[model samples]
Target: MRRQPSMLYLRPFMPLIVGLSLGFTLCLVCLPLLEEGCTSEGSVDQVARLRKPNSVQETQDNPKPAKSGGKQPFRARYISTELGIREKLVVGVITSRETLDTVAVALNKTLAHYIHKLLYFTGTRNVKAPGGMYVVTHGDDRPVWEIAQTIRYINDHFHKDYDWTYLVTDNTYVQGERVTDIFDHISMNRDVYMGKRVPFRDMDGYYCKVGITEKDGTQAFSQACILPLCRGEDVCLFVCLFVTMETILDLQPDEWLGRCLHDVMGISCVGEAEGVDYHTYEFSSTTDPDNEDSQEFQKAHTVHPVVEPTDLYRLHRRFAHIELDLLYPPIQTLNPCFPAQIKNLSHKTPEGEAGLTWPIGINPPFKPQSRFDVLSWDYFTETHLYTCPDGAPKCELQGVDRQDVDDIITTSVQRLNDKYQKQGLTFEHVRLLNGYRRFDPTRGMEYELDLLVGETGPDNIRDVVTKRVKLLRPLSQVEIIPMPYVTETTRLYVILPVTVHDREQVAKFLDSYAQVVLDIHENSALTVVFIYDPLDAQNIQEEDVFGMLKSMITYYERKYPNAKIPWISIKTDVPTQLKIMDIISKKHPVDALFLLVTVTDELTIEFLNRCRMNTIAGWQAFFPIHFAQYSPELIYDTKPYPATVEFGKEFGHFDVHAFDEACFYNSDYMSTRTELQKQRKENEDVSETYNLYEMFLKHSNLHVFRAVEPDLRQRYMPRTCNPHLSEDLYHSCLVSQAEGLASKEQLAKLIFEHDNEIKSQAENVVKS
Candidate 1:
């Protein structure tokens, strides 16, 4: 069985962290500075709140990045302890490139259609590299004035609270036809469509969502996830384009580009691209300051469809608006021309030289391999050593079937590294990825893994492993503790064989499984078991395997309590009921846990080793989501799906319509607050009116520091809510992954596939 991709990107905000206790989450209907402080009653956020809001309350002058030298219309405000005030400015990761890459191409095409035709984003094209990608307008065209107009218009009509948003573009290896047309049309007539979905539909709302993880650069799709919670006319979209700028002696990245366009820029695009005219706000691009300490508040916009328009808006602003420096206006204003003439570390700031990668968007935090990963895989395969298929990457081992992956990888690296040893830069950063074998189930499985710590050669098992381990992290500060929550309750299937009995007498054997559920540790809510009657089974009680499972669970529990082995039994030897095993597997999507007794005279069992392997892989893929929310325990029954026949004096059934207007009309203030309470629940802060953060809660025990509390499930669901999570994460994670693929120098396809497969499995289960 192929490993399933993760539902890690499935972020359902309405069901996971909607807390009665927490507050201060950004209304991510867009992205950035993902801090969730304890805001006032109106909102609830889960992340850390970064900074205070602008001091000037009447900050009406909005800086038109497109126009250059002007004040912005709105100043972001929130509750801040640093200022001892309510109106503070919070920061969080908006949609990022890595976040965008996971989105499938079909969704990308659909969204491209949405934006291109409406906005005239122009011909969507792709620039590909071995480890990078870029998707943007075919020819050279920027979105400055059009985005400016978009920003101004949105402020004038929709919302005045936030004037800044990120516009994330999609990552596409292939851009289908009609993408540009749809994008262009949307740009001109954004108001034609309601929201991302219709206003009153039972669908996803327009919100910018990002999955934040402290796990740095470990290539796993599950590490970062996202969902959409933003809607807008302006977008700070960050585009990821391939980097092929070796001519400039700059290998910035393989494929990436930061294509920004705010609502202001989109409006500008309308004029320049489509000749649409709107009243231009009398705004200069100068940001005035009275010597407040201001730092470059970095807000990233990843390009992808199904994202908060915030990133695209940013892209619009960055390119079409003004020089990038002004965007980082300090609260304590610093001259863009710093005392020493400010320049970025990469020397690519506004003053720095622009190059082929200028349009490419490869930002910092180059994912250095982690220490855990570096030492996690050691050469520990003592199983078999053999050669691969004839003429296929020729190997020199013994048996053809027994292959040593380490040998193959080692040889490849040695040959390649030897050829490039003359290069000056130390080849210390890169190494081999271990954990590359499947243990045989024939013998008791003892899985052991080790990360390469360096010392590899081209002809060796690996080209290189970590030789010099960097001790950079502050060991004193880094502490870890595991908090176990009530995870999934186990399911049990019993296999009781028929002895000296015909098929009709099988009910007597089936009745015992019901008794088993009642007999096992009842007080523990962590366990649930189901009994199955197999259609193709023939065996007696002693000759059967049902009794062996009881021993396995009993033995495994004592051995690996953490494994949480659940149980299920299959009763075989019945003539017709034997095929039920396939039905149960199909419906529950449960890995083949039940033992199928093949016939009455003898015992034939398909142990389902592959299913077990995939099941375990699925467990890891959704490790975050598994316990992140509540999942109803699914059980297979020997009996058919029983339909409840309700006898009522008056027959009643409600057919729900999409976007029902009646629900809102009947809602009272209390009901509205309740609904808002579910949607925008800010955690405890410092005050009743503005802040709700409780110091104790803010300084939570690190062990319980789930970004989205595992116990909390109301506002947005966790990666596990495949029903909700799959839909959201699928849309969000894949989009972000697309961005990552386009931008990240060396994209990790392994991580993407793992995450995608997990979600696919869950989705197939849901669909089936």
Candidate 2:
């Protein structure tokens, strides 16, 4: 009787009983709890979700927040890009033993550090080294590989990250053979600009045969017609970043050049604060009260690699490429990107029959360009240079000008000596401008290109020289910054601003763009990985930005069915303990996730690979870290979104939360992507949207606002004091009331108190 096993006999009937009773029992017990879990307050009432069906089969799974740690879940800014990114760009030092290697690592690391920060915020830098050599570039105009290097380094090393393509470089890439050569190649050829020569009565010594006739060949009034007929068009600007510890014993001048370019030379290039009478880094030397009070920022510059002890011609040589012609160069049709000019031809293809002249020419882009005079070989070749032949000296040959050589013989030495002679200098002063000769018949052209093989050609020399030629140094600490590449509206800002009249509404999808869009793996669509967003003023509370982001993401996955997606929302605001607390206060309104829970047992508390950390492919929810049991779909919330109480971690906490979705074909999501996009003339009658007045009205709902006081934060916490000390001060503060902790009206009242403080801070930061 005891062996009947408490209902063992019923166990025999258990199959049928379970078949009959379990559904009803679960429906009665589970349905009520789950329905209440989702519909409750302070949750991301995401898009499509489950309603109480008639039976247990439709019950929503509910997982509880892990009790181990006090952590606030994130409001995911939904970002998706189908990618297989290998998160490392091994920047090998390629240095000698321990010491130099350490220096290399430190310099590169410091460079990488500031570059990451600058790019994350401004998306720009003043100087960039796309390859081994340093380069000075406007943030917007940096070479593609340099931009990629910055993006990849940011993605791999920083807590907040970014990504680029395997090969998106246009100017240079792979650091192969020093891509700086490209600039040198472009600058080699030059125009022959002539100016009326001045008499050498004041300046004498440089020798040249001067025989001249007057304007009318009267009175014998002679002057050297100083015409600079430059032909170094193939020349370029290249440089070396000199690095050094002690030039006397250890560092060579060039090494110091390298080090300066590698780790320094950022702020020094421009005068501080526009016209501050101090060195760029002069704010330091605080304890050195006896130090000289500063005045008038000196141009930031490098002192090494001079042709003479006091001469800066080595740098000048590089600078000359740009300095040669303050006026824009004669545009050549071959240089496609340059603007059109009479010389840099306005059109490659001539417009329809422009007042036909005698000696009719074929329309350009054929043989012998239609623009230049056929009789004047020099004009045809030098001005409208195309895929055509203008024969003269070698009229026997193709496109050769025999008279061109004769013109060169007289013009060559005189042109070289002209500009230099005015300054009492001569041909020897020019490093690469050795004498030239006619192009031999052996090669295909009229000019034999000679690269003085003693030393290899320079790379990024112009940029190197540009930044170095202007250093305001000898005072203050140094910092390097990255060049800005992405636009403010386009970066993570793409998804940050969207106010749903109700978070309690079912769900709304938001879209984000990448700094550089990588190709989608399978479909015609792109795999755009969003790297960051400014901290949402609203997300500071409940960080369920992590959650709201989930809905937008569910939307993208649905809309772009064939494209795979991965995304993370990086809150750019630094945080404090109170701020972190504000985030945790509001738990998930509904936390249904596509989690691979099996990995939970092994997660190291604060490791970077945790489910919520930022990366090119979102957080690293690796195999074991994301899963718990061997459950196939171990989710506890409804589909498309989550339950408020279900979004937290069970055994481990993370900087981010992982959400998985197979959600597709969502009509709701599509509507939002095109929300602001106008469809047609018929819709023109629709009322205007995005008005400041409406924004003011919408923002009147104070409960959702988050504020910050800039003056207080900046004065207290700056890594400039001791970068490693602690970032406690930089953290954000959440002043709003906690979810479930306060009524909406109560929260609104508290929010308004800080609104003024926030508004003033925003204004001050802009002013500062």
- Each prediction's TM-score against the native? 0.22, 0.16
For model 2, what is the C-alpha lDDT against the true structure?
Answer: 0.26
Please give the RMSD to the true structure for each candidate, in Å: 32.7, 38.2
lDDT of 2 by residue, 1-768 (tens): 897678666778878887779888878888866875443332332212234444555336764433322234555454432342222211211121222223323333333432312222112454223323222232442222233233334334532222211111111001111112222222212211111122222232111111121100000000110011011111111222232323224422222222222232111111112122111111122312122223311121111111121122222223232334332345333464542233334344374234232122212221334656232212222223222343323224123344443343334434444534545533321122222332222221233111111211233122111000110101123445332232112111111121222232223112211112212221112211222235453555656544655556566677656544444333433322122212222321221111111101121223212212221121111211122111112222335432122222331122111111111111211222134234425454212222211222232221111111111100001111212213321121111111212334544655785697899999999999
Candidate 2 error regions (>4 Å):
1-13, 19-23, 40-768
lDDT of 1 by residue, 1-768 (tens): 233333444445535566522443444432454333324222221111223345645345953223323333454365443343321111111112243334323333234322322111222234221112223232322232322233333334323222122232232111122222223333321321110111112222221121222111000000001011123222323211232345223211110011121121221112112332111111112322111122321211122222333333333333322323445457226663442332234365553544223112322212236764322212323243322344343344455323344444443444344445655222332343433332222221122233343444455444544331111111121224322222123232323322223333233222222232334432221121333345323443436434544554465457544444454444533212212323333433223233222111111111122112222211111001111111111111244522221222111111111000000001121232333345444773211211111111223221111121121111111111112222433354344323322223223444576699999999999999
Model 1 steric clash total = 248
lDDT of 1: 0.27
Model 2 TM-score (2 dp) = 0.16
lDDT of each: 0.27, 0.26
